[model samples]
Target: MRTPLPKDKCVAAAPLCQSDGEIAIIAEFLPRRIELTRADPGCISFEVKPTGDPRVWDVCECFQDAGSFELHQGRVASSEWGRATAGITRSYSVAGL
Candidate 1:
Protein backbone atom coordinates (compact mmCIF):
# COMPACT_ATOMS: atom_id res chain seq x y z
CA MET A 1 0.00 0.00 0.00
CA ARG A 2 1.17 3.52 -0.63
CA THR A 3 1.98 5.53 2.44
CA PRO A 4 0.00 8.73 2.79
CA LEU A 5 2.02 11.81 2.04
CA PRO A 6 2.33 15.01 4.09
CA LYS A 7 -0.06 17.90 3.72
CA ASP A 8 0.48 20.90 1.40
CA LYS A 9 -1.27 24.20 1.78
CA CYS A 10 -3.72 25.26 -0.92
CA VAL A 11 -6.59 27.56 -1.75
CA ALA A 12 -9.64 27.48 -3.98
CA ALA A 13 -12.04 30.13 -5.14
CA ALA A 14 -15.37 29.71 -6.85
CA PRO A 15 -18.18 31.80 -8.19
CA LEU A 16 -21.39 30.83 -6.47
CA CYS A 17 -24.98 31.34 -7.50
CA GLN A 18 -27.00 34.37 -6.48
CA SER A 19 -29.78 32.44 -4.83
CA ASP A 20 -30.24 32.65 -1.07
CA GLY A 21 -31.19 28.98 -0.93
CA GLU A 22 -28.05 28.02 -2.75
CA ILE A 23 -25.97 30.06 -0.32
CA ALA A 24 -27.69 28.35 2.60
CA ILE A 25 -27.02 24.98 1.14
CA ILE A 26 -23.35 25.80 0.73
CA ALA A 27 -23.09 27.01 4.33
CA GLU A 28 -24.74 23.86 5.64
CA PHE A 29 -22.53 21.47 3.72
CA LEU A 30 -19.20 23.32 3.90
CA PRO A 31 -18.58 22.63 7.61
CA ARG A 32 -19.24 18.91 7.29
CA ARG A 33 -17.03 18.77 4.25
CA ILE A 34 -14.21 20.54 6.02
CA GLU A 35 -14.58 18.28 9.07
CA LEU A 36 -14.41 15.21 6.91
CA THR A 37 -11.25 16.41 5.15
CA ARG A 38 -9.61 17.42 8.41
CA ALA A 39 -9.84 13.80 9.61
CA ASP A 40 -7.58 12.66 6.78
CA PRO A 41 -3.84 12.47 7.41
CA GLY A 42 -3.17 14.38 4.19
CA CYS A 43 -5.36 17.27 5.14
CA ILE A 44 -3.81 20.21 6.96
CA SER A 45 -6.52 22.83 6.78
CA PHE A 46 -9.86 23.27 5.07
CA GLU A 47 -11.84 26.45 5.20
CA VAL A 48 -14.69 28.15 3.35
CA LYS A 49 -15.33 31.85 3.23
CA PRO A 50 -18.11 33.89 1.73
CA THR A 51 -17.16 36.99 -0.23
CA GLY A 52 -18.96 40.29 0.13
CA ASP A 53 -20.70 39.48 -3.11
CA PRO A 54 -23.48 36.96 -2.84
CA ARG A 55 -22.03 35.06 -5.78
CA VAL A 56 -18.64 34.03 -4.55
CA TRP A 57 -17.22 31.47 -2.11
CA ASP A 58 -13.61 30.86 -1.29
CA VAL A 59 -12.19 27.54 -0.11
CA CYS A 60 -8.76 27.08 1.34
CA GLU A 61 -7.28 23.61 1.74
CA CYS A 62 -3.94 22.04 2.59
CA PHE A 63 -2.78 18.62 1.45
CA GLN A 64 0.41 16.60 1.91
CA ASP A 65 1.45 16.34 -1.75
CA ALA A 66 0.31 15.89 -5.29
CA GLY A 67 -1.07 12.45 -4.59
CA SER A 68 -2.85 13.52 -1.45
CA PHE A 69 -4.18 16.58 -3.21
CA GLU A 70 -5.57 14.48 -6.02
CA LEU A 71 -7.18 12.13 -3.55
CA HIS A 72 -8.79 15.00 -1.73
CA GLN A 73 -9.97 16.50 -5.00
CA GLY A 74 -11.59 13.24 -5.97
CA ARG A 75 -13.39 13.02 -2.67
CA VAL A 76 -14.59 16.59 -2.92
CA ALA A 77 -15.81 16.16 -6.46
CA SER A 78 -17.78 13.07 -5.52
CA SER A 79 -19.36 14.59 -2.46
CA GLU A 80 -23.03 15.53 -2.32
CA TRP A 81 -22.02 19.09 -1.51
CA GLY A 82 -19.94 19.20 -4.64
CA ARG A 83 -22.78 17.86 -6.72
CA ALA A 84 -25.11 20.44 -5.32
CA THR A 85 -22.74 23.25 -6.27
CA ALA A 86 -21.84 21.90 -9.69
CA GLY A 87 -23.16 25.05 -11.27
CA ILE A 88 -20.34 27.12 -9.84
CA THR A 89 -17.02 27.89 -11.46
CA ARG A 90 -14.07 26.62 -9.42
CA SER A 91 -10.42 27.64 -9.45
CA TYR A 92 -7.66 26.07 -7.34
CA SER A 93 -4.02 26.77 -6.51
CA VAL A 94 -1.28 25.15 -4.40
CA ALA A 95 0.75 27.12 -1.89
CA GLY A 96 4.32 26.57 -0.74
CA LEU A 97 3.66 27.35 2.90
Candidate 2:
Protein backbone atom coordinates (compact mmCIF):
# COMPACT_ATOMS: atom_id res chain seq x y z
CA MET A 1 0.00 0.00 0.00
CA ARG A 2 1.08 3.52 -0.79
CA THR A 3 0.03 6.88 0.53
CA PRO A 4 -2.13 8.80 -1.85
CA LEU A 5 -0.98 12.24 -2.83
CA PRO A 6 -3.15 15.30 -2.31
CA LYS A 7 -4.10 15.23 -5.94
CA ASP A 8 -4.65 11.45 -5.89
CA LYS A 9 -7.00 11.55 -2.95
CA CYS A 10 -9.83 10.55 -5.25
CA VAL A 11 -8.12 7.28 -6.12
CA ALA A 12 -9.73 3.84 -5.75
CA ALA A 13 -9.46 2.69 -2.17
CA ALA A 14 -7.47 1.87 0.93
CA PRO A 15 -5.50 -1.23 1.80
CA LEU A 16 -7.50 -4.09 3.23
CA CYS A 17 -6.15 -7.61 3.67
CA GLN A 18 -7.28 -10.94 5.05
CA SER A 19 -5.69 -14.24 6.04
CA ASP A 20 -6.85 -17.77 6.71
CA GLY A 21 -5.04 -20.11 9.06
CA GLU A 22 -5.17 -22.15 12.24
CA ILE A 23 -3.65 -21.19 15.57
CA ALA A 24 -2.14 -23.66 17.97
CA ILE A 25 -4.01 -22.41 20.98
CA ILE A 26 -7.28 -20.70 21.78
CA ALA A 27 -8.01 -20.34 25.49
CA GLU A 28 -7.47 -16.63 26.27
CA PHE A 29 -4.49 -16.19 24.01
CA LEU A 30 -6.11 -15.42 20.67
CA PRO A 31 -8.81 -13.19 22.10
CA ARG A 32 -6.31 -11.17 24.06
CA ARG A 33 -4.23 -10.47 20.98
CA ILE A 34 -7.33 -9.45 19.05
CA GLU A 35 -8.21 -6.92 21.72
CA LEU A 36 -4.78 -5.37 21.68
CA THR A 37 -4.56 -5.21 17.90
CA ARG A 38 -7.97 -3.62 17.64
CA ALA A 39 -6.83 -0.85 19.93
CA ASP A 40 -3.72 -0.21 17.93
CA PRO A 41 -3.27 3.05 16.07
CA GLY A 42 -4.31 3.08 12.41
CA CYS A 43 -6.16 -0.18 12.74
CA ILE A 44 -9.49 0.31 11.06
CA SER A 45 -10.61 -3.21 11.89
CA PHE A 46 -9.08 -6.38 13.32
CA GLU A 47 -10.90 -9.58 14.00
CA VAL A 48 -10.86 -13.35 13.75
CA LYS A 49 -13.66 -15.65 12.63
CA PRO A 50 -14.04 -19.32 13.29
CA THR A 51 -14.78 -21.39 10.21
CA GLY A 52 -16.68 -24.11 12.13
CA ASP A 53 -13.89 -26.63 11.70
CA PRO A 54 -12.42 -26.02 15.15
CA ARG A 55 -8.97 -25.78 13.67
CA VAL A 56 -9.83 -23.43 10.83
CA TRP A 57 -9.82 -19.67 11.28
CA ASP A 58 -10.25 -16.59 9.21
CA VAL A 59 -8.76 -13.21 10.00
CA CYS A 60 -9.59 -9.84 8.59
CA GLU A 61 -7.57 -6.67 9.07
CA CYS A 62 -7.97 -3.17 7.77
CA PHE A 63 -5.48 -0.39 8.37
CA GLN A 64 -5.72 3.36 7.99
CA ASP A 65 -2.87 3.14 5.52
CA ALA A 66 0.28 1.34 4.54
CA GLY A 67 2.28 2.98 7.30
CA SER A 68 -0.04 1.60 9.92
CA PHE A 69 0.26 -1.94 8.56
CA GLU A 70 4.03 -1.68 8.63
CA LEU A 71 3.91 -0.45 12.19
CA HIS A 72 1.73 -3.37 13.19
CA GLN A 73 4.17 -5.81 11.64
CA GLY A 74 7.03 -4.19 13.54
CA ARG A 75 5.16 -4.51 16.80
CA VAL A 76 4.43 -8.15 16.06
CA ALA A 77 8.10 -8.78 15.42
CA SER A 78 9.66 -7.00 18.42
CA SER A 79 7.11 -6.44 21.17
CA GLU A 80 7.43 -8.53 24.31
CA TRP A 81 3.77 -9.36 24.13
CA GLY A 82 4.29 -10.58 20.60
CA ARG A 83 7.21 -12.76 21.54
CA ALA A 84 5.41 -14.39 24.43
CA THR A 85 2.18 -14.86 22.55
CA ALA A 86 3.82 -16.08 19.41
CA GLY A 87 5.65 -18.73 21.33
CA ILE A 88 2.34 -20.35 22.19
CA THR A 89 0.75 -20.26 18.78
CA ARG A 90 1.48 -21.88 15.45
CA SER A 91 -0.12 -20.28 12.42
CA TYR A 92 -0.65 -22.81 9.68
CA SER A 93 -1.40 -21.40 6.26
CA VAL A 94 -1.21 -24.65 4.29
CA ALA A 95 -0.58 -22.58 1.20
CA GLY A 96 -0.72 -18.82 1.02
CA LEU A 97 0.79 -16.03 3.13
Candidate 3:
Protein backbone atom coordinates (compact mmCIF):
# COMPACT_ATOMS: atom_id res chain seq x y z
CA MET A 1 0.00 0.00 0.00
CA ARG A 2 1.28 3.44 -0.88
CA THR A 3 1.22 6.01 1.82
CA PRO A 4 -0.53 9.22 0.81
CA LEU A 5 1.59 12.32 0.65
CA PRO A 6 0.55 15.42 2.51
CA LYS A 7 -0.55 18.31 0.30
CA ASP A 8 -0.49 22.02 0.98
CA LYS A 9 -3.87 23.71 1.22
CA CYS A 10 -4.52 27.39 0.91
CA VAL A 11 -6.40 29.16 3.64
CA ALA A 12 -9.91 30.39 2.88
CA ALA A 13 -11.67 33.36 4.29
CA ALA A 14 -15.34 34.05 3.68
CA PRO A 15 -17.89 36.58 4.60
CA LEU A 16 -21.37 35.33 5.48
CA CYS A 17 -24.75 36.86 5.94
CA GLN A 18 -27.92 35.66 7.62
CA SER A 19 -31.26 36.85 8.82
CA ASP A 20 -31.67 38.25 12.31
CA GLY A 21 -33.43 35.21 13.67
CA GLU A 22 -30.75 32.92 12.32
CA ILE A 23 -28.00 34.90 13.98
CA ALA A 24 -28.56 33.42 17.40
CA ILE A 25 -28.63 29.92 16.07
CA ILE A 26 -25.53 30.56 13.98
CA ALA A 27 -23.75 32.08 16.93
CA GLU A 28 -24.38 28.99 19.00
CA PHE A 29 -23.35 26.65 16.24
CA LEU A 30 -20.29 28.53 15.00
CA PRO A 31 -18.12 28.07 18.09
CA ARG A 32 -19.01 24.41 18.34
CA ARG A 33 -18.23 23.90 14.69
CA ILE A 34 -14.92 25.70 15.03
CA GLU A 35 -13.96 23.69 18.08
CA LEU A 36 -14.87 20.43 16.41
CA THR A 37 -13.20 21.16 13.10
CA ARG A 38 -10.04 22.53 14.65
CA ALA A 39 -9.54 19.19 16.32
CA ASP A 40 -10.04 17.22 13.12
CA PRO A 41 -7.00 15.38 11.77
CA GLY A 42 -6.32 17.61 8.81
CA CYS A 43 -7.58 20.91 10.06
CA ILE A 44 -5.12 23.66 10.89
CA SER A 45 -7.55 26.19 12.29
CA PHE A 46 -11.19 27.25 12.14
CA GLU A 47 -12.47 30.58 13.30
CA VAL A 48 -15.65 32.63 13.09
CA LYS A 49 -16.07 36.31 13.70
CA PRO A 50 -18.80 38.89 13.50
CA THR A 51 -18.23 41.47 10.81
CA GLY A 52 -18.88 45.17 11.14
CA ASP A 53 -22.14 44.72 9.34
CA PRO A 54 -24.85 43.43 11.62
CA ARG A 55 -25.95 40.55 9.44
CA VAL A 56 -22.55 39.73 8.05
CA TRP A 57 -19.97 37.43 9.58
CA ASP A 58 -16.55 36.11 8.71
CA VAL A 59 -15.10 32.61 8.72
CA CYS A 60 -11.53 31.51 8.28
CA GLU A 61 -10.44 27.92 7.97
CA CYS A 62 -7.30 26.05 7.10
CA PHE A 63 -6.87 22.45 6.08
CA GLN A 64 -4.17 20.14 4.84
CA ASP A 65 -5.43 20.24 1.23
CA ALA A 66 -8.42 20.36 -1.08
CA GLY A 67 -9.32 16.83 0.01
CA SER A 68 -9.40 17.83 3.63
CA PHE A 69 -11.42 20.94 2.88
CA GLU A 70 -13.85 18.90 0.85
CA LEU A 71 -14.21 16.55 3.78
CA HIS A 72 -14.94 19.45 6.06
CA GLN A 73 -17.46 20.85 3.60
CA GLY A 74 -19.20 17.52 3.41
CA ARG A 75 -19.48 17.40 7.16
CA VAL A 76 -20.95 20.86 7.30
CA ALA A 77 -23.32 20.21 4.42
CA SER A 78 -24.64 17.15 6.16
CA SER A 79 -25.17 19.01 9.38
CA GLU A 80 -28.77 19.66 10.38
CA TRP A 81 -27.40 22.66 12.20
CA GLY A 82 -26.26 24.14 8.91
CA ARG A 83 -29.67 23.69 7.33
CA ALA A 84 -31.50 25.83 9.80
CA THR A 85 -29.85 29.03 8.73
CA ALA A 86 -31.62 30.73 5.84
CA GLY A 87 -30.66 33.61 3.56
CA ILE A 88 -26.99 32.89 3.79
CA THR A 89 -24.48 34.62 1.55
CA ARG A 90 -20.84 33.72 1.31
CA SER A 91 -17.76 35.04 -0.47
CA TYR A 92 -14.53 33.09 -0.28
CA SER A 93 -10.96 33.92 -1.22
CA VAL A 94 -7.53 32.36 -1.10
CA ALA A 95 -6.12 33.71 2.12
CA GLY A 96 -2.54 34.94 1.87
CA LEU A 97 -1.73 34.09 5.44
Q: All candidates: CA RMSD in angstroms? A: 3.7, 8.9, 4.3
A best-first ranking of the candidates according to their lDDT comes to 1, 3, 2
TM-score of 2: 0.57
Which of candidates 1 and 3 reaches a greater TM-score? 1
**Cα-based TM-score, every candidate:** 0.72, 0.57, 0.70
**Which residue window of length 10 is worst by lDDT in model 2?**
8-17
lDDT of 2: 0.53
Please write out the lDDT profile of model 1 over residues 1-97, one tens digit for every residue: 4443334446556755668877777777777877888886677677777788866877677666667777877887898867877776566565653
Q: lDDT: which candidate is best? A: 1
* Model 2 RMSD vs true structure: 8.9
Between prediction 1 and prediction 2, the one with superior TM-score is 1
For candidate 1, the C-alpha RMSD (Å) to the true structure equals 3.7
For candidate 3, write residues 1-97 as lDDT tens digits: 2223333334555535455666667776766777778876667667677778766766667776657667877877777555755346667776323
Q: lDDT of each prediction vs. the true structure?
A: 0.70, 0.53, 0.63
